[model samples]
Each structure stands twice: as C-alpha cells, then as structure tokens.
Target: MSKSEEASQRPDTPHYENATGGWGSLKGVSRILADQKPTFGAFRTLMRQNKPGGHMCTSCAWTKPAQPHLFEFCENGAKATIWDLTRERCTPDFFAEHSLTELRGLSDHELEKTGRLTHPMRYDATSDRYVETTWEEAFEGIGAKLKELDPGATVFYMSGKASLETAYLYALFARLYGHNNLPDSSNMCHETTSVGLKRVIGVSVGTCVLSDFDHCDLILFFGQNTGTNSPRFLHTLKAAKERGCKIVTFNPIRERGLVEFADPQNPAQMTVRPATRISDIYLQVRPGGDIAVLAGLCKRVLELDAERGSTILDRAFIAEHTTGLDELEARLREVSWEEIERESGLRRDELNEVAGIYATSKNVIGIYGMGLTQHVRGWLNLAMLVNLLLLRGNIGREGAGISPVRGHSNVQGQRTVGITEKPENVPNDKLRELFGFEPPQEEGRSTVDLVEGLLDGSVRGLVSMGGNLARAIPDRARAEGAWRGLELNVQIATKLNRSHLLPGRATWLLPCLVRAEEDMQATGPQAVTMEDSLSMIHGSLGRRQPASPHLRSEVAIVAGIAKATLPPNPRVKWDEWTGDYGLIRDLIEATYPDKFKDFNGRLFTPGGFHRGNAAREREWKTESGRAQFTAPEALTALGAPPEGQEITLITLRSNDQFNTTIYSFSDRLRGLSGPRDILLINPEEMERRGLSEGQVVTLECAVDDGAERVVRGLRVVPYDLPDACVAAYYPEANPLIPVSYRDELSKTPAYKGVPVRIRTDEAGA
Candidate 1:
C-alpha cells in the first residue's frame, strides 16, 4: 500500500507522531545543535522572519520592521513566517483538480499542500470545487446572502491577530448591518479575565504598563508559562530579574523557561555561559486547583497580619476603594486548611512562604495567562487574584496590579478598537456624536454563544477575521460540523487553515496583506497601529513587498465589504476611510480623546505611547466609586472521574504551536520531537492504571454528551504531574471537551480540564 493509503487505513495513525515530545526530550540535542550550527550567515534570514512590519503573520499580530540584520524569532514564529512565504499557491487549477468532499477527507497537512490562496475563491457545489472569483462579486454575494438572513442570524467572529484598524472597521461594519453578534477569540481565552476585572475595577484591561514592570519590586506569576507561549515575555522577565525584582511562579509543570533560560540577546552571556535564572520561587500547584492555592495564601496573609501586627492588609485603600470586603473575608476564613492542602497539592509551609513574599514586598505585580482562565471556574480564579491584589492595595499603584499576559501582540488592542459584543460601560457617546447612529446598548453573543448558535442553526452566516475557528474551539468535530451549516462563510486570512476546509454552503476566502508585507495604497505605504499588552499603541509599517498584488489590506477589505453592502449609506463615509488608515485614527481620537489624544502624532513617536489610566493612580471607575469585592464560594470541587475512567485529561498547547496553527511537528522545549501524540501522566496515576512510560493506550472521553471520540495508541510518559491528572496536547485532545462544558460567567470551554478513561489497546489500533 502507498504511504498515504497505509496512513488512511491505520485507525490509530498518530497525527504528527514523530514530533510529539517536549523540547528537552527531543533526540540528540547535540545533533540538532550541530545541524543548526551558530552562524551569523543564517541570522539575517532568520531575522527577516522576525521582522514585524512586513506581511504580518495573519495568525498573530506581531509587528516589526523587515530589517536586514538578524533579530529574534521563536520556532513557531519562524513557521508562521515560512507558512506565509511558502512557494506553493492554491490556484484555480489546483481546486479544479480536487473536489471539496475529497479535500475534506485529507489531513490538515495535505490541505495545506494546495498552498497560498492567490485570489478570492467561492465554493461552487456543482463542480465540487472552489472557483476563482473577483473580490467585488464575492463581497456582493456575501452581502446579498446576509441581507436575506435576519440580522441576528449573522455572526461576526474576530480573531486576536486582527489589526486594531481592521477590528475597528469590522466592528463598525457589523454594527451598521444591525447585529451585535461580535464573537471573538477573547471569548475562548480571556473573556473571564476581562469580565471579572471590569466588574471589580470598572476596567476590562490590565492596569500595569510595560514600564510598570521596571518599577515592580516583586513579580508573582500564576498558572502562566511565559517561555513557551510568549517568548517575548522572557525579555521583560529577564529585565525584572536583573533589576532585583523577586520572581515567583505558580504552575503544575516546572517549565524550563520559568526556571532557567539562555539569553539569546546577551552577547557576554551567550559567549560565556548563557544560563539565566527566571523564577525566584516555583510553586507546583495542582491542575484545576488554583483557587485552593490562592485561598490558602490569602488566609495565611490574614493570619500573619493579625499575629505580627503589620499593616500588610491595606485598610485605608480597602475601605475607600472597595466594597463587600466583609463577605469576602468571611469566605476566606471559612476555607479549611485541610481542603486547601488536598486541592492545591501544596503543604502548609509552602502556602505560608508564598504569603510571606506577598506581605514583605512593597510593590508587587501578579501576571497570569490562559492556564488560570481555561477552567470551569476561571472567572472566580481571576476574582481571587484581584482579591489578593485589592487586599494589598496593589492595584492603581506604581508597579502593582493584576496583569493577564495576552497571547497575540494586539489581542488587547482589538478589544480597545471595539471588537467586543459587550456594550462599553464608559459610553462612547462620541460614536453617536460622530456617526449619527446610537450604538446598541444590548450585550451580544460571545465566542461560546457563536458556536452554540451555529450548532443550533440560529446563526446562518459567519465572517471571520484571521483565525481557524474550527480548530481553535474545543470539541473540534462539533465546531467543524456546525461550520458547514452556515449559509455564508467569509474568511479574511493570510494562509489556509483547518477552518477553511469546513466550508459553508457559500464560502469565500479573501486573501489579505500580511503584517510583514507592505500595505501600499493610493496615498502611499500605510502604517497600521497596534497596542501591546502594556496599553502602548504604536504604528507598524511593512517593509517587505506585498505577497501578491491581488492581496488587500484588512482595512480595505472591511471597507470594501461595508461599501458594497451598504451602498449610498449616508451614516458611514466608507469611501474616505477606505483609502487612508489615519482617518480611522482620527475617528478613534474623537471617540477616546482622554487616551488617544493626537492619535496619529503619538503613534509615530518611538515605542509609541501608553493610554494613561487615571484609575492607575487610584481613581475608582466601579459603580460604587470603589473596587467591588466578588464573593465566590469554593464551589463543589470538580467531581471525581467516572467509575470506569482511570484519569482526567487536560488538553494543552505545545511551545511550537499557537492556538490552532501547528508551525512545526516538534515541540522542542518540552523534550518532544517529530511528533505530538505523546501523553504526559503522573507516575503514580500511570502505576495505578497499570501503564508504563512509552506504553501505548487508547483514551476515551467520558463527556455528558453521548457521542464517543477516541484518541488511540497514544504514548504515555510518566511525569511529575499531580496524582489523577494527565496532560495531552490540544486540538488532538479537543474532542474530550464537551460543548456544554464551560465557565458560568465567561462561557469559555474548559479546555484545561477534561475527564477521560485510559486503557491498553489490545490490538494497538
């Protein structure tokens, strides 16, 4: 049989099997190093990949100038760059040769072989292929189809990678269309963080700016892996470490990046010994047990203050800037130490030590990522973090506040630009003042709601801005199946992805200019603005040439669609905005004058500028004129695994991967190579299940839904994970996540915690 045929026949064929181990475990580290011998010659090529300004990875909003000299680039970022710069092209001929049904059966890698989409393509069911179509025709068809559906039936999904300008235009277009169904990537990840933070402090964003990192005396990291997810964070962490700021980490895994990292940028360190310690204190909190760990710490801090007679708890700030402290304090005191130890997998001494650090630190910053937010009670988890900070008067102070480390470069910026369905509390009456339209006050569907609506057939149309929605959402099969039901699906992307394969009845793929590639227009090479995690907004101009002359900027695409859909609409000046991005900035300046003063002028400045928050200086924006304390009870612990299930499985992303895009077959940081099928299990759990390291096992998800999805012949490796907890790479294990399982407030799928059964596959099938 042919290799492809054999792969198809094997029921247990491992996806990226050869690339499945952690970076530390990848074979012959020396051999790889030898093959990748340090060479300044290759540096420029690698650096160009890192260039921000050129066609930006539509997968990520990372921006940089296309410099001639070598610069910093991660493995995944490199893959994203090459993926965009591939020689392959998905022309009309390629599509004509393959049927949509045939392509659906092909693996993600095989579909990618069709290559870059050179022109707008429309699904032609009669031919069973995608035929090249003009941009105008594509937009007109979409608009006409959308006009047929109830405005509420159309769902607009925005990815984190979209530029601020693009997001603004997209949101504006959606509003004009009369629907507020703006579901975004944030709904899947940090909606809880945004919602929880906003409810407590009246701001939906992190308070600390990048400069705040420099001023911090202590940095507390919870459930975040900085090295693998956000490599750029290493630079900030390194600086903080050098500045004598104590760094503490709380996570289940002792990630190498959190412990020691070889500074690629430091010449002296690289030449001599290139090891730098990252985390001053590492606490291995059990998975799904972050609340216990936090509660213990809070309890200890209270005890310490009472015994030592220290003013560790901010009495004046709490009274003046917060409410509901009595109830919060009552719950904190009621939490038993026994439960804390059992749930958090930490001893009493450890909790006390963490509390000591918090009490002693004059200025502290708490940084967290998705690990704390992709759980059943993610909102409460965020609230706990906020509670800790509020108790210490950390927020609104120099170098002190809760910071949720965002993934994409401008994910936060997208929110700032109004890619949110939730009505802004601080009404931009300016939108009414300028646009002559009253922005809807009603809340709209979030990402989870979008998927639910799709599944139920309430949503008939989907317009995505740069993301693989099918692969990114949990329960892949359900998401993919629902995607097929859409009446019209439009994707503005840089490259092909799994989501593209799950086409709607009438699907259109519109290729757009990448961030690294120049976005030239009638005016000239236009620079787009993006805000970093620190609230700093800067202009990014592409340096490299366009990928294709046919490609359009996201801003242009949004404008084109809006103009084509709402022809002669006097409320929107689509023609004027389509040609220049500065006009959009002017509108933004008008809307958010307090923060975006001289938007165009300030964005041109070096390193851009931060949107100064008066709240950062202790001004309360909450309803009560103070931060509100959220009282979250220790909800009944996640129930134990079913009788037949041996262990609970948690899905996670590898260092080489970002969300849904698999940049490479290997996850170098996790000792994985050439495969992504290995499962990490606790040694004790493995022994209990009669499994050994490298033993192949079949894992079955025991979800509330009756549907059965099995991942077979997964190599199990015993590791230091907590008892009863097992970890597998995501998307592959996404099937285990049930559509019904989600956080109460945020509605984010609990991708981090899933219950499953493991057993030896007798046939190894």
Candidate 2:
C-alpha cells in the first residue's frame, strides 16, 4: 500500500467522526477517572510504525538510537511522529477553496485540518489565496524583498530542528547582509541556561556528554520528565539504576514517565510487564523554588564537610580553575535553615538526606531542563546549579558534570555554528580572521525584543529558518498582530504550520528538505551535523526520498537568498558553499577550531565526536582561575497569593506535545485525552475552592501591567500536585504570562511560575 493508504488503515488513525481517538482519546478518559495508564510501550511501537531499521524518534535532541531492536519512544515523540506521518495533505486546490481571511477564522485544529503542504506556495493578494510557486520564483521574490529592507530591519529566526550546516549558512547570510538580528527557539527555552553558563564557565553549552550518564553514581534531575521529554535517556537511567545509582527527582508535578518507565527493549518486560523505577526521592518543589532547594542542599553539604574535617570538595580543581569562592560561601552561610525550608517546601531533614546522597557519591550528574530556566530567577537557578557542581568539584571528572537537556535536534549546534544575536568572543575573532571582515560588535535583538520591535513596526521583515513564530511567542494576539504589520515575511520550512498563516504584506513559504529526507548534490548525498544534549556533535544522513522533487536543502535556499540580496562582495564565496554541506563544516572548523577539530574527518566516524568540555574532568574555566561560588540570598516571600485568587496556575507541556507543536490533543500518560482545554489541579485545592472534577474555571493573570489575557471554561482534573500549585498546558496558557514577567539577567519567560486566579461561574443559579 502507498504511504497515505497505509496511514489511513492504521488502528491508531485519528477518526474525524470521533475527532479525537488513539492515545489522545485514551488520555481523556484517564483524566476523568484521575488515574495513570500504561500506554508508553504501546505508544512507542505505534509511533515508530514498525518502520524498517527501527529508528529512534527525533522529536527532541536527546533521543539516541536504542540497541538492536528496542521500541523506545516518549509520549511527545510519538505525537511528533504521528503528526509527521499523518494522512493529511494541503494541495493548491485546498488553498484555492479558502482565502486567508476565511482561514483566519478557523480554529487552530481546523487550519491544521488541511494537512501538510506538499509544494512551495506564495500568497496572491488579488485572489486572496495561496498558489503553488516555482522554487526559483519563491527564492527570487524573497531575495528582492529582503534586498529592499535595510539589514537592520530584517530578522532571521531559527528553530531547534535546523541542522548545523543550515544554521551556519543562515548566520553567514545575515552577517554578509550586515545584520545580527537572529533569534531562535533557544531564546524561548534555554537562552537563560546558556547566558548563565557562559558567564560562570567559559563555554555556553552543557559540560557532560551522554557517556557521562553511565558513570554517574548519583543523578539529580530537576524540572525534567525523562520518560516524556527524553525517553532515550531512560535506558541510561535503567542501566544506572541496575548499577545502584541513586536518582533524585525535583518537580512540582509528579510526572508518570519519571515515576516509572517501561523498557521496550527487554522481551520479558514487554510480553509480561517491564518497567524501571526512576526516582528514589521525588521532592515536590513549589514553582520557582529551585534556587532555594539547591542553595539549601549546598549549605548542608558544607556543614557536613566541616564536621567531617576532610575535603569533600575537589580543592585542587577549584583552586586552579575557578574564582569568587569566598563570596559564594558567604552567601550560603548567611541563608538561614528556616527560610530555606519554607521557600523550597523541604524540611532541614530532607535537605540533609539529599546532601548525604551527594556526599557519599563520588560521581554525580546534575541534569536540568526548562523547569530550572523558565522562571523570573532562571539565570540564578542555573548559576546555583553550577555552584552546586563546583562545591563538590563535579567538573572534569568521571561521571560528574552539568547537563542542560536541549529541546531541538541541533539547537546547540546552531549556536556552535554562529546562530547568535550577540557574537561571542571566540566566534567573533574567528569570523574576523576567516572572512577577513570586521564582524559587527554591536548586540542585536533577542526573541522578546524582536516581538516588541515588530509590534512597534521597527522590524520590517522576518526570515524564519524553521519554526511557527506566531504561535511560539508569549502573547499570541500581540505577536500575530505584529506579523500582520511586517512588509515581508519569509518562512523556509519542511511543513506548513500556523506561523505560515500570519502573512506579511508580501509572504513566501519556501519548501525545504527534512532531516529524514535525502539531500542530493553534485558531489553525492550530503550529510548534516547535529549536536545532542550532551554536547556530542554527530552527522545524520537522510536515506529516504525527498518529500517533494522541488524541495531544496536549507543551505541552498539560504545561499540563493544571499546571492539575490547582497552586492557582489565575496569575502567568503557564496556560490561555492551551496551544494556540499561539508564546505560549511570546514568554515565552522576554521571559525571555531577548539570545538570542531577536523570537523569533516571526525564526523565521518561511526559514533561522531564530542566537543571537548574540560570542565567535565574537574577543570574549571572561570575568572581568577578557580571555581567561583554564587551564594543565593534567601527568597523573600512574594506577598501572599493575590487576595481572592483560588489557585496559582503553572504552565507545562503535555506528554503528547512539544514546545508549541501539538502532535495530538491527548496526554495519555496523564490520562488526559480529546482536548487540551483541561487544567490539572490538586484535588484538595479544588475542593477547598468548592470546585469539583470537570468544573469549568476561568484563569486570569494577576499582572501589575494593564494587559488583559484570559483562558475561559477550562476543565479541571485533580492530580498529584502541590496544593498551592496548579498545572495547565503551555502556549495555550502563554497568554497568562506577562511580557515583563521574565528572568532579570537571562530574560527567559517565567512560564513555569506565573501567579494567576481561578474562578467558576454559577450555572442556572
């Protein structure tokens, strides 16, 4: 059977009559009953579709190909795969039937109903429809419009899925055109972690590679759900557990995946029942209370060391490579136990137990995700993680370091290949040396700044490498409105998403090749590089046929735009860089020798290569040549919850969802299905407010700013969450987050920690 025919025949197919079925339907029923379900193993196999070679899901960068024939897939990964392999298609005729205005009125689900775009398209104002356009015309039109705008007014945004080669060329094109306004999905997620790490350590990437997980004696995971977010890491966790590693979890909500994960690799476990125990000590922390918890742990560790009268920390490593120790120690000493317990929602005894685990384990791994970075004090939280690692001299050692799990396949690689609004010291100097042109020294706009600029008409053009910017930004209404004002909006993507609907006066959607599809050049098939969450750089060669014959590689598309926009000033040859992605890798190597030594040569190897992180071996790279300590002051209580607010809402990702991409409406692991309109609340909190399961509640942001944003009539499902805290799906709840509510230094949106009020309307009173 053909791909489409086969997809329709699948048992897990979405039934339009039902509107919601498969795993999503199962989740909805589970939520109603307030119970967890064991659909992960089945969901894993269903997502992969029994494809030959048995590949791992590529939803997040963290997924690694499992051994021989293991069926391993996370809930979100399943959704991503299902979405990609859906039996949906949006042809030119479909566009002809609906005008942009008509499509705008359609729900997000209805718009996505048209299926995926199969060809390049352009918007025609006269017909009020999008018509299929040739690759040359699309490229030429984008180049012309971009040429008209001053480079300063143009912004280049990238998503996490973009390969390293494409990212490198995207950055080169912007630089060649004299603009540094390159914002990406990273800005929306892990920018705070990057900013904090760069200041504390010399590098902005994670210190540990995946191999480090195998050697860890103790794993401290904060604000991350491995089963749903990074299922591939479960194997490592399972291995570590079998070897007696203590895994401690700190998250507000009790994630099913983190609690118990089933391994599809073992036949006995699969045929009968095979599940791995994930967390030994699951600490239920209040939202934005991570800093306090970490500080308390560090303080207890210090106290323990003092009593033992022996060096618990790697003193030699700290003295040689870090600075600011005295200040960090003083801050930790000043924080009282009373304040720590109250703020972190953990008692002194609990802190001591956690510290005791760390004290006994010679090898520890600290893994963090958006939970630690999506708060008002996200940067401080990252700094605190670094401080905790430094306290025990975790860096530059076997099985010990800081690991920031990145969201996209090549998000970190993009940064390595020069995708940054602000140029780093090494990349800047190298760009100057390689291109023989003085790179811009001035800073450029971040994601938040880009939105603000677009709203005010300062940003005239937007070039998205990949991503649905309109749906991804904080305030949906404001962000979409800003895009409407743009003179030109160009989207280079493999699929059609909501961002494509937010047309500029002149808009172009250029079709590009996906990482899973082939990219043929004059030389041969080209390979693209991606950096994993562990800072390991590797190459991916797509074997499947191109989704469309007309589709071009991102590198070629970028080069075409550059050739059309820029005057013939060849500091670095543009035409010569199109076909072979290896040429781009060579440029990256020339620009960043320390990270990409013999980039092309090493990439050809089977397992690829690791970007050297000396700090992983106890070599600190901070000012003063010694590990510096950053003592966090006691968190001053934010005056009691807003007077009359029933519950505080915290935004989170459903198991079947990712960043802003909704693979399906169901959250099987959470027992939620059918729709994402439900809010997960603690049962006690709901009863205290005189609310019951399935009750509709209106969530309002109690912001100091005058902006009004509300999500109404959301169903409430009681779950195992802290009493004062309630959890709702993100992007849908993004409106509740105020633009001003961001981390002080990193400027990350405090999506994980927002103060809001819930109210129920009386029916037929």
Candidate 3:
C-alpha cells in the first residue's frame, strides 16, 4: 500500500480523560524536550518567557500578568521555544541530500522536523536541490529581479513570527518600494475584526486591558479554543473564575481548555489533578451559528429590557455614546425565533437564559478568535457582536469590552505598525513627510487578491518574511501550481517549510535568527518589542547564543533588501536602523507619536505599556464621532450550501500545532494521535450516513467553480460535535476552501463553515 493510504488507515487512539493542563501537559512538554534534546539553554530561555526583562513567548498573543508566575509558558509554548532551540541543524549537506520532490512528499510535521536552516541557499535547478550561496549573492540577485518588475507586481507578505521592529521596517520598506501591497498573516485571520470594529467603534483593536479580567462580572467566549491556541489564557480564566466572575463559552467542539483547567504553574493543582472548573455555562454552538446566536441574544435582551421597565438597557449611556439603536432594534425584532433555532441549533429559551445573564451583569467582556472571523460574513459577525455588547454599554467600560484573541504573538502588532493592503489604513502624510516617498494611494492586493493575481499572470514575484503561504492559503492545489511560474520567490525564514519547495525561477532561502537566539547587529546585541492580543508591548531579549554565524536578524534582512532595491534616500538610514533596533522604535514613535510615545522608555515597564485605545477612551474616530450599532442583513453567518448531502466543515488546529507549524503527530487534548488527515464527525451522524470508524473518505468542495477542489485519504473518527457539522485540521483541509470564498469587507477566506460532500474513498475499499 502507498504511504498516504497507510497513513489514512492509522487507527484512532483512546481519548485523553484527564483535565487540560495537568500531568498530561507536563508529559507533553517532557516528550518534546526529549525529542529535541540538548536544546540551547532551554531551562534559562523558558524561565524568561512572558517575564520581565525576557522575551515574549512565540506562541499565542496572550499578555503577561503584572506579577507573572515562575513559569509562565504553556505546553505548546515550551514546544515552540525548544523547537527553535534544538541542537539539530539543516546544513547545506542536508538540503543537498534531499531533493525538492522528496521534501514535497513529507507531511507538515515531518517537514518542520528537519531542523533549523543554517545558511542562505538558492534553488539550483540543474541539481533540483537547494545549494549554499552567500548572503550577498542572494540579496543582489533578488534586488535586481525586483527592480525589473513594477512595485505592484510583487507581493510582500509578513508573518507573525517576527518582532515589531522587523514588521515596522517591512512596512516602511514596502511603502518605500512604491506600493502598499503589505499582506500579512492577519489577512487570513483577524482582518475581519480590524475592518468591522473600525466601521463602528472607530478603532481596529480590542478595547479591554489585561486587568479587566479581574473586575469583569461575566466573560463570554465565542468560537475560541483557548486551551490549544492560547493555553496561557487559561490562567486568566482560572483567576477570573476564582474572583466570582462567570464564564460562558460557545463552540461546536467541547475543547478541554474552557471546560476545566489545572494550572501547570500551580503545584497543588498539578499534583492533586483536581482541575479548576472553568466555564459556568458551555454551549455547543454549531459551525457558522455565531451570528444567529448573537442576533437571538440581542433580540431577547431588548425584549427583556422592555419587560423590566428599561432597566436592562443602559439608556443614558446609549443616548450619550452611540447611534442607530432604533434601526438595530427593528432589525433584531424582525428575526424570528424559528430561524434562530434552526440556524443556531439552540432553543429560544437557551439564548434568553444567556441574554438574561448579560442583562444582570454590570460589567461583561466578550472574547472571540478566528472562529468568528473565518466565515463568509465574518466582518458582519463582528458588527453584530458589537451591537450586542453596546446594548449594555460595554464599549468604553473598564471591565467590559470585546477581545479578539489573535493566534500569532505579534500578528496584531504587525497590523498596528502598518502592514496592510488598504493604503488609507496607514498615515500617508506622515510617511511621505518622513521617508520622502509618495506612498501608493491605490489599495494593494490582499492574500486572496495576490492569489488571483498570480493565477492571472499579474503578480510575478513573492517576498515572504516568514509564513508557509503555499499551505496556509486556500485551494493550495491551484495556488502552488501558479507559484512555480513566478519570476522570483524569496523566503526569509529560520527553518524550511512547504512554501520553500514551491520554487520559482529565482528562488532564494535566506536564513534568519529565531526569537530565542541572540540577534547581534553591528552595534551590539539588541532587543525587539512584541505587541500581545491586548495591545500591550513587551520587550523580547534573546538569551541563547546564535545558531549560526551566517544568520541575520529579520530587521537586517529587510534593511538589506530595501537598501539593495530602492535608490538611496538620504532621509532613510537603513544601515543605521538595522544596526540598532532602538533607533527603529524611535522612528516608530515619531510616526505614531500618540500611540507609541516613549516606545523605548516603556519597553520593559513591569507588564509592558498598553497602546491606548481610542474607542476604549470614548474618543470614537468614526465619521459620526460615536459608536454605532449594526444589524446583519441576514440571520445566518454563512449562506446556504448547494443542494446535496453536504456537511459544514470547520477547520481547526491540533494541540501539537501552532498556526501552520505542526510540532508533532499527536493531539493529546482531543485523544487523537498520528496523522492529521482525519475527519471528525458526530457518532449519530456517522451511523445515519452508514459511515464506519476508520473509514477513509474523500471531501469535495461544494462550489460552482469548474475546478475540482478535493482532499483524499481522510480517516473518519466519531467525535462529540453537533449534527451536520464536521471538523478537520487546517491547511490540510485548506485545499477545500476556495480563494474566492471570503468575507466581503475584510477579504478573509471562509476557513470555517465550508460546505463539502464526504464520500468513501475508493483507495480504502
């Protein structure tokens, strides 16, 4: 049998019965440490993560506490840190041994396991392998190629893996190159939050501070699996629960993180295995049902406000700080109970019960993740969520607001420092005045737009800072083919990924320093800043020695490219900024004086400085100068699927993975191990469809596009999920997601709620 077929036939292991983050978590960490043995200062590096005078964890964007615990890192964070600090090296000989064809056949986990990249390498077509080349040769060759094409023809993509200094330089470099085509990881994830919130609240970020969790009376979580994505957040939830704060969660899968948590930092809890109960209420919301559930809650809250003599609604606050209440109320009233029940998979009374909890609570905070944003109407979903929160005056309150937990530690920071497709999002006048360049006024291509341009032969090159674009993007089969025809493809990365294999005519793999490794520039060792999910900026100082002498910092890499590509601008000192990151911070402060004042001074101020939020301060930047309540045009978050026996497919991450990087083949939290190409379905649904356990299946996208988008050799596993709703690992299932299928306003691909038909694979038979 073929290797792919053999992988599809791997049997499901017994589910883990322990609570999230107990002995099981410690075991997971130990296992990773054992695999990547003799890590470079592993103990010292982990001790400093999320702590004062230390670098931030490269995992989730969770903020550190004022007084962090002895070990603030989580299981996955440890994996990420150790994964970077591994002794294994992918030297020139390693690449020469493995051909591109051989690398392409490996799984995501296997590809990343190859170890850290040691030197700059260029794709040698003659040998069909990557051969070592000096940094100067790679940079000069790429610079020459970029000079040949129009600035708009080449796309500059950034990932969340880099520091804020790198992101700032990347944005500046893109604009200096005469285009604003700065698409980052945000384009695929929380672009919906930024676009949606700005339209109503006048700000593109969350309004809550980390301290707000302490004072909140209630916290509502939607479509976020905090355990796997942001395990450190479990500490915040546990603390809130102990302080008499109620927690309610809505997700299709019963993620162990929200249900209960045993803090790894707490010796008593870890030893006893008596996990602290987390969610006061757990609602199994069906995929793409968040908007319907939110609409139902809004309607019920308004009704209760009337019945209770207007006491439930903050009438005075509404009159003073908001607009469009009457229209929102009318729209909410139009939504029928039957439609809400059918779409949300919940009864009216259940929604009313939750709404009642909201009405009684003086201060409530709503937290969400990609689940709310990776939908067709993702931007609208955020608007509707804001409407529900605004009814009780949650916008500018101390302990009541909206928090969109971002996946990458610095993804939010990248957008904040000016990586965006929309030209207007950045300060054009300030940039033109400071950098002496005419910033492009026309909107640039987003991730989705970039893919379309590639397919149409409009985009000729891709300069990605640090993301696996080939696998992270939708319709991988179609996009990867177009990538090969490009004139240039440059990837500045610390390790090899699937994207490096999709080599263009001029492909160069430039190695950079990881966050855990010291980045010594021309001046001396430097520190980089990272902004967390709550808008707090923390300084990251690497303690370990450099992995290789040839490695360059991301800031230096960007500066090298910029200096080589653009004509020498006297005002911009790329060489000096690359030598000292603090200088870059000074310039960033100069650009956004109000938001980043004293950037260097506040780099290590205990818990880091909070970048002030205008909406949180009640200073709305909207056209009306006040918060606006919006209602969805439709009750459903996603439109109806084409006629067939199709099920809603929600793409998710495994406990062993962080973003697109798969650390191991095991997902301990879900009781699954081995291969990620497994489809999770409810037992009753499996029985109803005459599907058996361990059955290999093929999923085809239910789209009208002539091209067939399908993934084969997926093992079926019965899971505890809502009927007609199945789940699959992201990027693996990403091929089934259409590039054109995205949010209208934000342009985020609908990774969640994808409609697909599953049939038994002929290979398994």
Question: Over the stretch 557-605, how does candidate 3's per-residue lDDT look in tens digits?
Answer: 8999888898998999999998889999998898889889999998888
Candidate 1 TM-score versus the reference: 0.90
**Comparing 1 and 3 on TM-score, the stronger one:** 3
Give the per-residue lDDT digits (tens) of candidate 2, residues 1-765: 321122111222111221112333334334422322222332443433213233334578773532323444444555555454344567778888988888878656566545556778998888888898887788788888988898898899999888888888888788878878888888888998778886677567788866777799999998887756776677778888888998888888666656665565565655565456677878788777788888888888888888888567767766777777778778888888888877787678877888888988888889999888877778888888888888777876778888888888778778777888886533777777777777776677788888778867899999998777787777666567778788998988756677888888899888777665567986788878787787767676665555457778888888888887877766667777776678888888887888899998887443347787755655555564445567675452122344566355678776656677665566656556777877777767777888778788888777767777777868877776776778888777877776667777767777877778776765201
Model 1 C-alpha lDDT per residue in residues 222-265, reported as the tens digit of each score: 87777667665676777888888988788876666677665555
Global Cα lDDT for candidate 2: 0.72
For all predicted structures, in order, the TM-scores are 0.90, 0.89, 0.97
- Cα error, residue 625 of model 2, in Å, equals 3.1
The model with the greatest TM-score is: 3
Q: Each candidate: what lDDT? A: 0.72, 0.72, 0.87
> Rank order by TM-score, top first?
3, 1, 2
- CA error at residue 398 for candidate 1, angstroms: 1.5
